[model samples]
Target: MNSTLSNNPAVVIGIDLAKTHCDVVGYDKNQKIVLKLPRISKEKLLERLTNMPRATVLMEACGGSHSFIRKVKALGHDGRLVNPGDVKRIRCGHQKNNMLDAAYIAWAWYIPGISFVAPKTQAQQDLQSLQRIYQGYMKTRIEFGNRIHALLLEYGLSSPQTSRFIAEQLPEFIETHTKDLTPLAEEALLMLRDSWLEASEWEKKAGQKYDELVRANEDSKRLMTIPGIGPKCAGALLTHCGEASRFRDSRQFAASLGLVPRQNSTGDRDTLGHITKRGPKHPRSMLVQGASALMIMADRLEGALGEWVRKIKASGKKYGVKVCAIAAKLALFCDTKDPTRTVNKKPTSAVTKVSGIFG
Candidate 1:
C-alpha cells in the first residue's frame, strides 16, 4: 500500500474492474485524488480494501459487480453499482483508460439523481443464472425443432407442430421412410432430433430447478398471488427486482421494469410512445407472457382486474399495448398488495387508480 493511501483515508473510491485486473482511484473529501492503484489482482484489491478506513465504493454494474459489492459491504464499506450510462453522462474528457474510468466513477458518485443498481443477493443471482440457462436450452430446442421441421418438409413429410410430437414421431417416420430421404438427409434429421431431445430434457430440468427455488422462497410465494403470475413468473420478478420496497411506489416500480410507455410532453402537448423495453429482458418478457395469458382468459376473469382488461380491449388499443398495460398493472398490484395481509381482501385503491389510468 502507498503511504499517501495508508495515511489519508479516502472518502470515496472507484474501481475499474476487469476479469483479472482492477484499477482503483480514491478521492479525499476535497475531491483530490489521494490514492491510485493501477493493475491490482482481485485478492490484492480485497486485501487493501480490508485494511482501509470505510468509504463509499463506486463501480459500474457489470459482470461480477454484485459479487464485488457483496464483498465490499462485508468489509464495512458502502458499495454502490452505478449504471454505466450514468457514468458516461458525467464523464468529463475524451481520453479514456482504466485509471480515468475509475476516476470518472468516483466523480459520478457525488452527482445527485444518478441512478444506481441494487446489488443482488447470492440466491437472487443463482435464480437468475438458472433462468438464463433455461432460456438458452429452450432457444436451442426451438431452433433444432425448426430445422427438423424444415428438413422433413423438404422430403414432403409433414410432422405435427408440437415439439414433443415432432421429437417422438419424426424418428419413427424417418426409420420407416428411410428410402424416401437420402442417406445424408436421414442421418442429419436423426442427429438434429437427438439434439432437440437432449436440449428439451435440459430445459425441463432447468425449469424444475427454477420452480423449486421459487417454491422455497417466501417473496416468490407472495408474488405468485397475482392473477397472471405463476411460479416461474414470480421467481423472475423477485430475482430481478430483489426487493419491491426499494421502489417509491408501484407506478415507479412498473416503470423500472419498462412496462410503461415512454413519454414526451411540452406545454399543452403530450405524447406517449411504445413500451420502453428498457429493463431486464427476462423479467419484462415473463411479465408480458403472463399478462397475455390472462388476456386470453379474460372471459373467465372476474373482478376489478377482469373489468379493467375488458375496458382496455373495448377501447381498441393494439393487442401489444393492451398486454403492456396489463403487465404494468400487474406490477403495481404486486408492489402494493401484500399477500400475507391482503390476500383475501378486495382490490385496494392502488388497483383502482391503476385501472382508472387505463379506463
Candidate 2:
C-alpha cells in the first residue's frame, strides 16, 4: 500500500469512512486525480498515509471520523473535517458513491469559506461520552415514567400528587392501585417500574462520573463561573466546542451553538427570524434551561446582567424569544477563552457575581 502511491503524492485527500474499510480519493493541486482507492482496509490506509508526504486530508464528520482525524493529525498532516451536507452540495455527480464522496471532500479544500470541524481531544471526547450516557439514561427513565402515567390513566386512576411521583412514591402508588388493577395491568406496571429503576441507577452512575470529571477540569470550573453554566452544561459545551480557542470570539461560539438568529436575505433587503438551532443540540438545550432558571430569579440578580435581562424583557418579544436571546448571551459569556470579550458592553461582573444560584 505504501509503495503503490509514493510516486505521485496528492495535495489533498478525501476519505469516506465506514465501519471496516474506507474509500480514499486524492487530487493534485489542479483538481486532477493523483490516486484513487476504494474499500481499503483502515489499517492499510493509515499504513499508506504514514509512508507518504504530509498533505491535507478531508472527511465528512460522522461516526469513527474523529478517531481517524486524531490519527491523521498525529501523523503530521492537516486533518480537516467537512459537514456531509457541504460535500453533497459540491460533489460533481448526480450519482452518489464512495468515490464521489471522497473526491468532492478533496475538492472542498479549494472551495473557499467552507467550515471545517476541529478535532476534539481525548479528554473532551470522554466528557462528551459521559454526558451523552447520562442524557440517554434520563431520557429512558422519562419515557418509562410517562408510560406508567398513561397506564394509570387507562385504569381510571387520578393523576399523581406530584410530577415526580414515579421516582418518589411509585411503589406505594402501585400497591394502592392493586385493588383496582387487573392481573396484566399490574404486571405491565411492575415491568415498567423495574425499567425505570434501572435507568435511574445508570443515570446516577453517569452523573457521578460527570461530577468527578468536571471537578478535576480547571476549564470546566472556570466555565461554571458564568451564570447558567453548571457542571453538565460545562461538560457538554467542552465536549461539543472543545476549547474556547476553537472559536475566534463569543459571537462565533454562540453561533456555533445555534443561538444566533437564522438569516434569510434577498439581494435588496435583509431578513432575520428564529435561531438556526443548529450545532450540538444537548448543550444548547441545556443552556436554554439554565437561562430560564436565571430569568425566574431575575430579581435576585444585580448590575449589568440584571439590566440586560430587563432590557430584553422590555423589548416586548414573546417569552420564548426572550429566553433564547438570554441563552445566547449566556453562551457568549461562557466563552471565556477571551475573557475580555463582552456582549453589548455588559461585563462579566453581571454574570459571575450572581452565578452561585446554580451551585
Candidate 3:
C-alpha cells in the first residue's frame, strides 16, 4: 500500500479490475488520495478490502467485475460499477496504465452527474450465461452452414436454403452429383455436412434451453407476447437490459441499447446519422431480425403496431430501413411493457408517433 500521510479511513476506493490482479486507489472524505496499491494479487486484494473501513468501492463494469462486486458486498462494502466508456471521457491525458486507470475510476465517481451501472444479480447473470451459450451455438451453426454452401457452390451443386433441408437433401444431392464432384470435394463436403449437422442439433438444443429459461422467467414470458419476439429475442433483451427501471423512459432505454440515431447538431442546425450501434450486438440483432419478420408480414398484423408497420412500408423506404425503424419502435415498446408487464399496455401513441416520423 502506498499509504498516504493522513490517518482517516478511505471513504471511496476505485479498483481497476484485471484478470489476475487489480490496481486500487482510494480517497478520503477531504478528496485526498489515501491509498494506492498497484497490481495487487486478487487474494490479497480481497483481504485488504475486507479489513478496510466501509467505503464505496468503484470498478469498471468489465469481465469478472460483477462477481467481484458480489464478493465486496459480502464483505459489507458499498460496491459500484461504472461504465468504462464514461471513465475514458473523464480520464486525464493520453497516457494510460493500470494505476492511472484505477485513479480515473475513483475520480469518475467523484465527478458529479456520472451515472452508475446497475449490478446484475447472480440469477440475471445465470440467465445471461444461458443466452450466451445459445448465441455461440447459433454462430457455429451459421458458420458451418456457410461453409457447406460455399463448398457446394464450388461443385456447381446448390445447397438447400435451410439447415434442416440441407441436412435432409445432402446425401441424395451428393449421390446424384457423384459424377461431377472430385473425391477430395466429396470428402470435404461429407466432413462439413457432419459438422453442420452437429452444430444444427446443438443450436436446436440451445434454443430449447432458451425456451426453458423463458418459461421460468415472468419477464421473458411477458416479452414473448409481442409478435415476432420469441424466447430467443426475449432472452437477449433481458440479458442486455436487466430491468426496465434502470432507464427513465422508453427513449432512454432505446438510446441505451443504441437503437436511436446519432446526432451531430450545431446550434443553427440539427443533423442525425445512422444508429450508434453502441451496446451489446446480440440484443440489437435479435430486435432487428424480429422486426424483419414483422415487416415481411406487416399486412397480416393488426392494430397500432401493424398500422405503424404498414405506414412505414408505404413510405417507400428500403426493407433494411423499414426493419430498423420497426426494431427501434419495438425496443421502445419492449421497455414500456416489461418488468411489471403492466402500464403502457397499448403502444398506439408510441407506434403512431414513431411511424409518423419514419413513415
Candidate 4:
C-alpha cells in the first residue's frame, strides 16, 4: 500500500469491491487516470486511503459498499454509492474488467442526472439483517410444511389448513396410517414432520428477535403509529427508508418504495402502467400487506383515511391496485414526519389520531 497516491489526492476515486479484494481507479480533475490499483486486499485498500486529503470517492451500490463508504467518509473524503445500473449504462466498450468497472464508476459519478444511493447506517444494516434472517426462516419453514403436506397427500391423507395443524396432529395421523404407508414412506413423513416443527420453532424465534430489534429503534417506534403497521412492517420501512428527509416530499418517498405507477409516453401520447418495482421487494411487499390489512378493517376506521379507502373501493379499480394506492398514501403519511425527531415515549397521540379515523 503506497501513501504517495494519498498524498497527491486525486479528484475522484472509484472502487469495485469484492469479498477478498478491491479494484480501485482514480481520476484527476481533467478526468485522466491518475491512479490504478487492482486486486488490493480490503485492509490494504483502507490503509492506502487513510489520512488522505479529502476527495470524492465513488463506488457501485453493492454488498459491502455501504461499509466501504463509511470508511472513506471517516477519512474526510466525500462518498457516493451509484446504482450499478447507472454505471452499466455509462460503461464503454464490450470488454469489461474490475479496473474498467472501477473507472466507469468514477466517470458515472460525474454524469448529469445520475442517482446516487444513500449509504445506510450501521443500525439500518442491523435491522435489515434481522429482517433477512426472519424471511429466510419463514421461507424454509414454508418449504418444509409444503413437503410434509405433499407427502401426506400422496398417501391419500388430507392435512388441516392451519399452520400448526401438522405439528399437533402429525403423530396421531402417522400412527393411524402406518399400516397404509410403506415403512420407508412412514419414516420419511415422520422425518419431514420433525423438520417442519424445527423450522417453525426457528421462525418463531426469528420473529421475536425482529420484534425486539424494531421496538428498540426510535424510528421504528414512530413508524408503528401508521395504521396497520406492526413491528415487522415498521422495521422494514425504517431499514429501507433510512431518513425520510432524503426524499423531497411524500410522493418521492412513495415512488422510492415502488408504490408509484410506471409511465410510458411518446410524442404527446401518454400511457401509465403498473409500479416499476424498482426497490427492495420485502419492504414494498410489507407496505402493501399493511395496506391490505387496513382495507380489511376499513369499516372500523372513521376519519380521512377510512373515507379515502371507501372512495377508492367505490372507484371500481381492481383490488390489487387499490391496495397499492393506499400503500403509497401510507408511505406519504410516514414521510410527513421528521425522522430525527425524538419520539422516545410511546406514540399515544399519533396512534390515537390514526385510531380516530377508524373509530
For this target, which candidate reaches the highest lDDT against the unseen true structure?
A: 1
The regions of model 3 sitting more than 4 angstroms off are 1-5, 155-158, 334-359
Worst 10 residues of 3 by lDDT: 350-359
lDDT of 3: 0.79
Per-candidate TM vs. native? 0.90, 0.90, 0.87, 0.90
Q: After superposition, how far is residue 90 of candidate 1 from its true place, in Å?
A: 3.0
| Candidate 4 segments exceeding 4 Å error | 1-8, 337-359
Candidate 1: tens digits of C-alpha lDDT, residues 106-135: 888788777789899998899889988989
Q: Which residue pairs show backbone clashes in model 2?
A: none
| Candidate 3 collision pairs | none
Q: What are the lDDT scores of the predictions, listed in order? A: 0.81, 0.80, 0.79, 0.79
**How does candidate 4 fare on TM-score?**
0.90
Model 4 lDDT, residue 240, Cα = 78
Off by over 4 Å in 2: 1-7, 161-164, 334-338, 341-359
Candidate 4, 59-96: lDDT as tens digits: 99999999889988888889999998888788745579
lDDT, candidate 4, equals: 0.79
